[model samples]
Target: MGRTIFLLISVVLVAYYVYIPLPDAIEEPWTIGRKAAIVKIGTDLASFGELLGISHFMETMQLLMKFQEVPPTSDENVTVMETNFNSIPVRIYIPKRKSMTRRRGLFYIHGGGWCLGSAALLTYDTLSRWTAHKLDAVVVSTDYGLAPKHHFPRQFEDVYRSLRWFLQEDVLEKYGVDPKRVGVSGDSSGGNLAAAVTQQLIQDPDVKIKLKVQALIYPALQALDTNVPSYQEGSHFPMLTRSLMVRFWSEYFTTDQGLEKAMLLNEHVPMESSHLLQFVNWSSLLPERYKKSHIYKNPTPGSSELAQKYPGFIDVKACPLLANDNILRQLPLTYIITCQYDVLRDDGLMYVKRLQNVGVHVTHHHIEDGFHGAFAFPGLRLSERMQNQYLSWLIKNL
Candidate 1:
């Protein structure tokens, strides 16, 4: 029995090793090395989970994150304080120098596929502090609930509540901030929250101060279309795999483990929401540059059962990519960054066109050799330059 079990495990490992979905076209030596290193460490970690009989992906991922260090909590130029926005936890950063003109206020949400992460200086804290000091602005970083425990619209609500607190309170005067220059921004999953809050705020008449702009750094905008070209292209890339992304969303949206795999084929979108697909169709809506030789499938029928079951997906407040023209037309100026090697590239690219079509101004920067998590990744030279460029755009716009 022991030998039989060992043989079975061996066969499974060999199969996974032989057919691991890898990017077949990368030719650059450094990129190949970087991808190889990522794949190696990732393979070891994943294999470790399987060996231990750990079946839940989120728990496995949380274990894998133990390899990273927790960065220092303080910044010399900016004073940091922990506070709550309503009942939700938030950490605020204020620059030391008082601005002659009221400074801009930025709300930042940290990204971790909505499973695990914090508002610490390590994960996404560096850029927020840099922005506060560089732009001389007040920065509020939020702490939202993790998955399998807290789900969709929960994190969205936390972010929205923080946004409302910023809008309703005289935070601008309190922090010497300019009400006209405030904006929200986030990276990855945080980008997802930031964009959703931007759309949700459009109809809030009681909102005392309107956000002037939205900055999305490689955000995952919608769960409706997983088969988009970028999904296929970056499907097997380093760091984020197509299957892993499905697991991420499933962990956040539905506890129905059986439905997770089906949803990757976009089973979550209901047939009734067919009318909404026109707004999010990547094939026709994306720019020619984003188009690869690809096959496009009209969302299969019966997709709406999940929509009918969950319902948060069809709502514009949760998925900004499907927001109506009434909301899109009124959105603040936007800044978006897309990475060539990221699975969600086309999502942001398509949103750029969506905002532009509705007469909203957009500042888009595409990193040709960059990957999805480059904003928080310190090693990549292109990402570093892109981060500086992003902060520069914020300075000019504010």
Candidate 2:
């Protein structure tokens, strides 16, 4: 059965890669051993599910990817619990030791492109527990609604509700959490939510706890800019290819037909949005260091119909990069983590520039040799280092 599954996956991967080859610019330029590991794990999971003849592929994929999280154990210093914020489910991590005073609080959202991934998965379990133990803070991660099923604004609403619970429920007081020291963080799509949720917190006049900060790990902040340096540079990099990202967005937003392909070509921007381009258009704003050797392209005109069909694509709340200066100015001091080989690297960089421009305190750490989703593999030394650095800053700031 194992051998059969392997052969089946090999055929599928070969077919996909061959029939839909990437531009040479993206496909033949670089090499890395870690890329093979990502492919192997993902294909193997799919193969295993197909071999088992499982009717539910989504569940199988979630289970396999979860094998990627940090392994939970008898960490006597930390205890884990399951709870809910209104209608949304959440997993909480508490340090076993009694605090001398109120502990800092962190609410996390896990990333699976808004289609897959779980806050309760062992991978996130490992991350959350480590955070709780290392920072000596309480951690909460939400299982926000997934796409194509629960739909748009649903995931956002769930995250907002969960964060509000942190304050309204006096959750901090009950758990001895520091009222003014609470913050939010997420990886990938979760990072996207964390950003939006922070904005929501900032705008709510009645918000009880002051959200002091946000930490984003290679977040997917915008769908409007496809030709950004990292998008091009990491287009062919392992794990997150340009095409796969489009698929993720398509499912998440259920965008109009043929829009995904246009998005990849950098022609997806609507004419109505032409005025906003000068701000987010990477060619003008990106530093020389970020552009590297690749030349930038002008966004060719796309259909106004597309713009009409999915105006939400340009909404500041949906794509935070499109946010106006006023909104950007109000964001809290933030920490953004970027990886050299990740497609979304430029997204993080672009946001860093925006944050700094508005004089929002911004601390960014770019890993010299890291790939997208590198932190998911807890065994890697680089992954461990990444978490430590991020946690160090988070703990200090909180």
TM-score, candidate 2, is 0.85
Report the lDDT tens digits of candidate 1 across residue range 33-72.
5544665566568657767887455666555665553543
Clash count of each predicted structure: 4, 1
What TM-score goes with each of the models? 0.87, 0.85
Prediction RMSDs, each to the true structure? 4.2, 5.2
* Top TM-score model: 1
Question: What are the lDDT figures for the candidates, one per model?
Answer: 0.78, 0.78
Task: State how far residue 30 of model 1 sits from its true place (Å).
Answer: 5.1
Estimate, for each residue in 137-229, the C-alpha lDDT of model 2 and write its tens digit. Answer: 999888888765765677788888988988764677887788888889999888888888887777898886778889999998888777778
- Output the worst ten-in-a-row residue range by lDDT, candidate 1: 20-29
